[model samples]
Target: MQFTEDKSRSRMTLRSAVPKTEQKPERKQPVQELPYIKYFGNIYYFTDSIDCAIYCDKILSQVDKTPGNTIIGFDMEWPFNFQTGSGKTALIQLSSTIYDCYLFHVTEFKKLPKALTELLSHSNVRLVGVNIKNDIHKLSRDFPGINSTAMLNNCIDLRTQANITLNCKQNWSMAKLVNHFLRMQINKDKRVRNSKWNVVPLNNAQKLYAAIDAYVRITLVEMGDKTKVFQYNYENNTVDICINIPFYDSVEELTYILIKRHDLPIYVDKDLIQKLSDFSLQCNLDYYDNSTTELINHSKLNAAEVEDIIKDWERLMREETADYGEKGCASDEELFATAYHKLVHSPALETMLQLEYMYAQTVRQRVNDKDQQIKSLSETQTDEMNKAVDRLEEDMTEAEINEIAARHFDDQTLLQVKLTSELETIKEAQRREYREWVMQMLEQNQANSSLPTPKNSPLAPVPPGPIRETKEDRRKILQSVVLEESFTIHLGSQLKQMHNIRILSADVMDFCAVNDNEQISDTTPQLLQTALGLYSNDLCGLVLMTDSVIGSRLTKDFTEICQRSTEFHFPHIDDQLEIISNTAKKYQMESCNNRNSSSKHLQPGDVYITRHSNLSQVHIIFHMVSDDSLRANDINSRHPVVLGLRNILKTACSNDITSLTIPLLLQYEMTEEMTVTWCAKRAELVFKCVKGFMIEMASWGGSDLKNLQFLLPQGISSDVFQSLTGMLPSIFKVSNPLILKSSSIVK
Candidate 1:
């Protein structure tokens, strides 16, 4: 039999001269090949022509008919696009066993031929490729929206298989792979590789290059042993790793290489095998009896070199487990016990006893101080309330009282008296409950603070106290408690309204300022400390909103707070910056295309809050779109202000802060855009929103209400302040006006 190619018909034919005894054997045609110089197997190149495509279809059909699995080396080439990383797939090269290679010029045709597509999509065909995922990605990109069911399915990546089985490195260059596996060097000239693949007529080198790439992939797989390739044994929980161990000189070297390659631990178990150092030359004859020499076979280590190697390995293990004077001696424990007993009996014990006594005395003293403060405040509040009630009783004349009673009930009615008494009983129960909760929180804080000191240490420094108390702290504490008391709602009612919320004219930033009120000498901080009566760390954090994206910009008060917190309080400013920056980067800017037509500027409710370095404050940034950009971007006013405030409060509560401060108008800087009418409206909206948010706070998995500071802009005049104040009563119904009016000191 001989094989010959007919260029005119573009087909290869096989012929036999000899005839069989029964009948003449049927003539066979050689595999079709394109009009190229054949080098071993036929190489077929198909272009855009209909006849060429038809010829390619016939070739695929013949290759698909092969028995068993049809192994095809698949590869694709496309021009490089620096901007997009890759362009369209220009060529699709496929090669079969030994004598068949097909080069399909995919770019020439608008769509791939049906027969070619079917062969590619064939489940029976096992297409072998190197880095096939990348090729599939490129193909998908070139033919957008095309069904790639066959391209990826049943695809075996030669590189991946080789890495797991042959210990080949990932991303092995095609040239290096060819040299390594085929033991033959293949030239991959840069000029040829980087050549434009979109050009019509392909160069000889390009053809050879593409063909070799596909052919080599197939040859590599054919050369490898499939059965012994890195099989995993699930039952035994082991891997059957196959490698060319002959590359190493000895079993030890090979083991070392394998351990290093797989990053396996090399620590020897000293308990399992006795170290050579432990096996002294002077053995106990009762146990050893001349069996020591038998442990090492004479025949196995007759040579000095072999004996030396075994000795070296033994020495290595001994060195690894050696103590080397770093650990304590066995007798040290006995010595420690003796010394401890002596110390306990000596004057050191007396000194420790004295220190403990002193610490307990100091603790009691602090506790007494706190108790005194609580007692004074409670007595003052009770006396004040009693006086107010007496004044009200005195103010009402007997005739007026009788008239009021007559208006509400008949002369013989006792129902009014009964209802009044019941109301008083309910109020007393609520007050008791509130007091109990406060006491519990204070006790928990005290227990936490009284952590036991180490027994061995005789002298330990006392922990620092909370931030130094100032007049402003007292004011804030009083105001927060007052506000909390004032905002109580009748839970049974369907409508929950904020009741008796007081309005203050002073700047909220003055919370830490000094006050010289002779009657109330306590500072705001001191008052707040007494009010919380917990660990100083349970302080409230101020949630101030700003308009900066990266937090690089801040308002005056916020900047001052950050500087104070970072410079004097927290030393880890770098870490804080990194965390804030990373979090900021995560919220990427929204594109206009993704924004709604009437709503723009970062989804109205977008707010980011980060804890300040001071650990006492949280800085909140509201993503406020510029006013001019608001119309163009279609941003809603409902969010990033009211909604943002709710989010901030929720965050503060979640962070275990029972008290928080927020600007009522959601702005620290007032502009012409904020008029008196606008301020009143904004204040009213904020008041209602805050009321709802506080009511919902109980269900939002937040801590119980402690304090809330509603700040007004500094620019507001007396009239505007009063106007804003008037709106507060409508939302926050004043239940106890007399108590608030007497103590409410609006700075």
Candidate 2:
């Protein structure tokens, strides 16, 4: 055998040459790398409508043969002037996979392609993207002739899907989603993302960026794992997600490589798996269950094609059941130990889940409330229709009676629609307040408030919001006339430390509404309470001074603020109150001395605690029960309500609550009887008692009160507000040590 071998490639060939092949090393084949994604796709750019249509038609013909729903990644870009806002849509991107992507420059298109339009608006096809609805809206805005909004029924919002699947907020950006799924960077540079889309001959970077954005949409939708993850977008344009245990390795890369090896762009062949998944679409087994012969007959394929499919399914089934070298390689204990190596305890994750559970509960309660409202409205409509029919019998047509009923129904819906979300009732109140304030502003500037427009309606103006003062931007939109004074006061004799003391006339709820009403954006870190504070004992408390009726209907005035929709993770305020009420009943059973006392009824000065997150500012709310004695003209420091305030301060000191908000008047509101003398006395009593409590705080070792805000009613008169504010300084001695500089003249 050796004698016949060629002399040049013979037995000692190891000396002649080292191992080599015709193929060269392949790079990762990254097309564009920015921020964090190595996009691999060929972008097909077309300016002419005809060319685009032809390309799409060719792709569509091929797609028809592919099994499954036709999902298209869709995105758009337009020219923008910093001074004039966004211009008309200049380009639209579409892709089904990384290898296949198209950017149609609509600015150059003399005519929009019917095929492309049909594809976008098709009921069977799904156009997927983050904030896809807004992109579709832009199409209508740019092309006024097309009813894109009404026609686009096939759009799938990845943002919404991410909320359900990833357990992320509904405002995650495309860059964020890509980083999460692909474990790569996505270029979001202002220069690249906000480039000139209307310009002809798109740059290579623009083409690649545009293609990557659109192509990723389909990739995300098709890459179905349905894994729940917790994400925090606490900083600007940055998000951190839960680094889950066990399976957070190269499984994604392995799957991708396997699919690539088989010449598949995305996923491996899953004909059998696909059929099994179809069972979820319906409950009837007959729809999915069929013999191989029947399935083949209905497949509408030739014998050879059908055989190939059957073989693929059978191979997949065998592979699924076959030994994966698990027991042969390692025991169950070894596998578990390996998995445990990657396991981690996430305190932040626990807090987020808690918040999510709370938000879910609030949402459920809101849904129930809305359902009742809708039910009542329906009943009212029925009654009104019946009355109109009876009253107008034979006098008017049935149509006329129906018309009146419809009008009523419409009015009711309009009124109730204001209560849709994000505390619409509060929003409406804000609007009304702004409208009035704007009228006052116009009157101040001598602009005609009664000036009529062409439509003959008076010139009524309202600011964007009544504008909550919690936001720094709130100052930019509106001005406040709140009478406030702040003093840095030292408390505790031995451990005398500086604390923030503020006396302000504002709504009590203002302290609890966690200053998150600003638009949720890349910068906004709303919803979940930060775990940093959760662990460090930097807790917040709000003294919710309540009436002695515990959880009665009379308590809604103050407690309703807590009942409003929280971002996520805390029970509804009413639910918390109910729990507190239940606990109080038990407490009364155990400790009540007076057997004649009305079972669970709370006495004056008795305190009940409720915990919350994502509720405005406070984590713990102390619902201190008090009687109408607060409304009296002459209540001394010995009053039960006063004693309750002392207890609240004491409990707060012993606990980890670093900040506390207490109602200065010991009431949520001011009355006509709460005269200047009464206000001064109440403020003095609270101030002196709080000061004494602070000195006593050092004796009970815990977190010291760093900030104390004495909130007065929003409607407090300037004189009274000032009188109380002045009284605070007189009571709590804010230390102001004078610093003197000595000038040296020594030689």
Candidate 3:
């Protein structure tokens, strides 16, 4: 190794570095200009069939002669008005590199002809255009075979290609692309307002307009491909554009797409049209040329006024009668009825006829006073002779009575009775009064008779019975019933009785027991009532016992059980009762003592035992209950039972205990049964005994044991011990525990 340091060599290398030079920025390149065509001047106008045919023939010849792939630029122009049913196209213009320019007069093909049919059917020609789908739709009215696939495969749409190539920010229209790329703006004013192509003698301007559209479309196709925005890949025999655009091949497919895009054409009713036309004519009848020309000319009202009156009259008739439904009769009937009703009720119509005889009876009254005068004079006389004559006349007619009276009395007797009786006095009086009235009436009648009787005078006439009012003859109308019959049914007696239960009654237990008797006639009703009562009790009990033994067993060690019980939605009363019973039994069993005690009391060091046949060794959980009433202290204190149960649970679960036997023992000093057999049934006995104690304790002002404390034995592992101990606070506040040494008290 060379021990000499190379410090001089390093210094010489560090000093030999060269100085750096500054560089100048590069200038931007000017954009290259794209090839453009002015596209000015008329491009060979073809307005008539003769010119169109000649143009098409020329283009076809040129296209036929051209070798290799021929790119024919095609576009169609059709009427776009959706309101009209006329399916027509103004022009079909086609152009190619080999051919000059051609315009086909579509109207000549048959003014609203199927241009799509003719063009789409030709397989040899591949049509190309921008957004030709709309054209295909209008054309499909005639040619139905052009669909998505046909247009997509055989026809090339340049708009789609441009979109793919340019990575365009938005869908661009043909006019938009032409202005943006070509920098040439074609006016759309003529395209929309141009004369209907279906009309004959197309103008030169229209023909030129069509030709330029085809040329512009061809230019866009070339620009799209050159930009490499969309690369044409023939490997799959499909054109791969920038975006996936759905295609149509046949007229049916195109029509389906059109329907999906633009909605189907609406059809108007022919009957409605005829009715409206007829109505219009009827409304104009008064002004008909054949009718009185002067009546029409001289009328002060205008046509609109007459029409308004006609409409009003029609509306009135429709409201008054059901000759029409609520929608009213057809317009024709409405117009006719309106005119007829108005004419009949016109004020200018002639008056009705009146009869003289009918008026005479209505105007006259005749009063008879001769009979009254005779009766008054006869009553004043001592009339035995007259009375006898009246009695004889009762059984005989006047002629018979006159003959009998003549046979019975002579003419002298008859004459004396006639002259000397009081009748003469009455006759004389009547004659005097008559002479005076007759003299006065004769004078008045002589005056009035000369001047013709007054027609309206009381002496002249009185109208018959005041002419009965017409309104009295009409009948009162009744309100109409909308529903024919009732559709609901009433429940039977048995079912009704079952529905009358009061769930909240305090005698729920008694009711359930009574309901179980088979002798009860109305079993359903009683059972339903009991079940409802049980449901009410259970719900109320659970709410009240949230801090009791039941709650402790359910809410503390087994909160999930409590949640399920509370969350259970009992739709029927029976279900609620069943759940309460089952829940009570489960809590009672879970809180049982199942560990050993040989000593008088349980202690911390004493081993409690539990054995299963499958287990090789006995499992044990130490017993400890917290003295603090507060739950937090109990949980944190690490009580012996809590720690021992935790260990027992961990071992049992880990070892998979198949069978277990436990011995029950009292924690406090007591002389209670501590045998294994007694402990086996401990849960049931404890529940019954606790329930008894609860009753007595509750009576003594102490809370029920069942509601206060839960019982769990010592001897299980820590996990089990902790779980079991955790339940105690929710029920009873544990205060103390016993400890034993050598089966004897250590304290």
Candidate 4:
């Protein structure tokens, strides 16, 4: 895996050696000349640093001088693969027939003058491209300012347009469209061929390929009459207009809008990551490496003999319960039974199992040792603090006691602080130690002796420094500190800040009061107020969860509050339907208005209203989206109602309850099985929404829910109705039906 001095050349040689049967043939000559030039399209060709700078200047000047408005087609090509650790867009090839083709070699552009950066960010000039979001993402990775005001105001992404226009069909590729409509083929043989764009003396074929890519986008606009375009009003789903342009503004506005949207967090079993990594390494070490050598040494054996043995082993493993069943095989059962057998049996296979095993074991051991050390240090500090507290309890004067307590607390706190500081100092020393150890080991093995020193290797010596707390840790610390402050200051400040907030207006306040009165019927206003209160209470409970001292108590309070909220449902049938429809639509699903129709269950995007007129009952319906529905189903089948309850549970009770959302189950006269099924589906959806939210949060590097685990307690199974009624009281004793009625059911 280590590269020597001729790393680039080595990589190229390896790429060239790869079997080409599956790959598209490279272009042998420049594309056949066009019979006629029907349109006067602009093509900007950029290859060198000088060309890119000059091209950018020319485009900016044209944008500044253009009258009225100008629409331009744009697209970018970049190098991407597993080899590039940073996943950066190695080169940015942008094109427009109107402005010509410009290949901004991002590698060089990053090093050039900052003037071009400003020109690219210019607001008036729009950039039109297919899936421009990705292009922007790639650009922003290297140049943080690329997305600022300097960039154009309107960034039209053709992918979004195609999605809307084509009713979400799959064929939105640029090449596909050109081939289908324009009767011209734009070759992509070298698009991802891994050629280095930074090299000098580019050939004519590469230049032509770059030029045509830009030209095709421009040509699409000129021939807009040939395809359908979709337009819609911002407020409604109804289509407003249809028109075609070679390019439209990039989806920067939509991107910004989505950036503000929040998603529920997904709960990942952190343990799974380590397990998978270990399992994969073990498999490679045992099977992949050994098989390669075995095949090379026993080249006389026919491939069929090896394949048969693998297949027979797989069948026997499936029938028996052997401890090492598949693990004993060089290839695990899955691999041994599949493509790996053929690969390992190949005469030309390269053997590296023993080497790979040594490398993986070395790395894994180091990481595990570091983790164990950190954990041990933390536990030792905790034990010391406990002992200090026990000793302090012994008879001491008030002043002496106070002084002792303060000193003990400070010392305990500093244990970690000091350890962190020390760790940083030792890290530098360790880096040097690690490097020497690795070099000595490599020399002894003589395996990677020919390889040059790895500059970016994990084992490479690194400078020591304080390990910065993660964003989540920082947020938790801030929340804890804020909570510890005087309540009067915090409460008074919050109230003052919210005095004019529309969510807490006179009307809302009046409704809250009215809803509080047991005498009043559950009117729509009361229902709305109750829902808002539940949401607010849930948020308050979340804030309380951040407090280490009061998390469990706050969670119990939250559950009680939610139970009370859900008891007071909307009195009117129409209002209930409206609430359900509105909530569902906000979550981007259709209202389940026509429940009597063929569709009895709510689909992924369907929201519905169910009215039990006989019982004078109303409920809203929503679906759950989850990647692992089966796992969710198992949990929900045990405790139905607890699935949607957002009540903060005491930390001592059990489970990590980072987030919870209430869901409305709207099925009438349901049997036990039916109710459990319904609740399980709802729970699955809630988990899905949370998972999606977590993904979005992670994408933006949000730290609020980082490292937070979620769990459903055991022993709470069967229909949600029973689970809710039983578990609610045990977890949160203040379970008034009236209070439960007021809780909001979030989609």
Among all candidates shown, the one with the greatest TM-score: 2
| CA deviation > 4 Å runs, candidate 4 | 1-51, 85-88, 96-99, 111-115, 148-153, 169-171, 190-193, 225-747
Model 2: residues with Cα > 4 Å off, grouped in runs: 1-481, 492-495, 514-531, 553-575, 595-600, 737-747
**Local distance difference test, per candidate?**
0.51, 0.62, 0.37, 0.38
Q: Candidate 4 residues 614-644, lDDT tens each? A: 1111112112221223233344422422332
Going through the candidates in the order shown, the clash numbers are 15, 13, 45, 54
Task: Identify the leading candidate in terms of lDDT.
Answer: 2
TM-score, per-candidate, Cα-based: 0.34, 0.39, 0.24, 0.25
Better of 1 and 4 by lDDT: 1
Per-candidate RMSD, Å: 28.8, 31.4, 45.9, 32.3
**Model 4, 740: alpha-carbon shift in Å?**
99
Ranking by TM-score: 2, 1, 4, 3
User: What's the lDDT for residue 498 in model 3?
Assistant: 10
lDDT of 4 at 409: 65
Candidate 3 is scored at a TM of 0.24
Ranking by lDDT: 2, 1, 4, 3
lDDT of 2 by residue, 1-747 (tens): 001113663211001011122123545434255345556756789988888888777666645655544667889888899999998888999986545688999986655787777667755566777788888887877665555764456566666655544333657788766765555667777887788888898887889888888877766654442222222222253222222222334444534443454344342335323432343333223323422333444344335656887888877766676653223476544543232222112322332233333333444466458768777877888897787777785677878987887798787777567556545444344334323433343344345423212121112342444534556666623434676888888765575788999888776665554343332212223333442354346788888877777666435754554545442234456667788778878878866645536545788888888776546456787888877777887788788877888788789888889888888878767778878888887778788888887777767877888989888887788888767766666777687777755665354
Model 1 per-residue lDDT tens digits across residues 428-447: 44334323433343344356
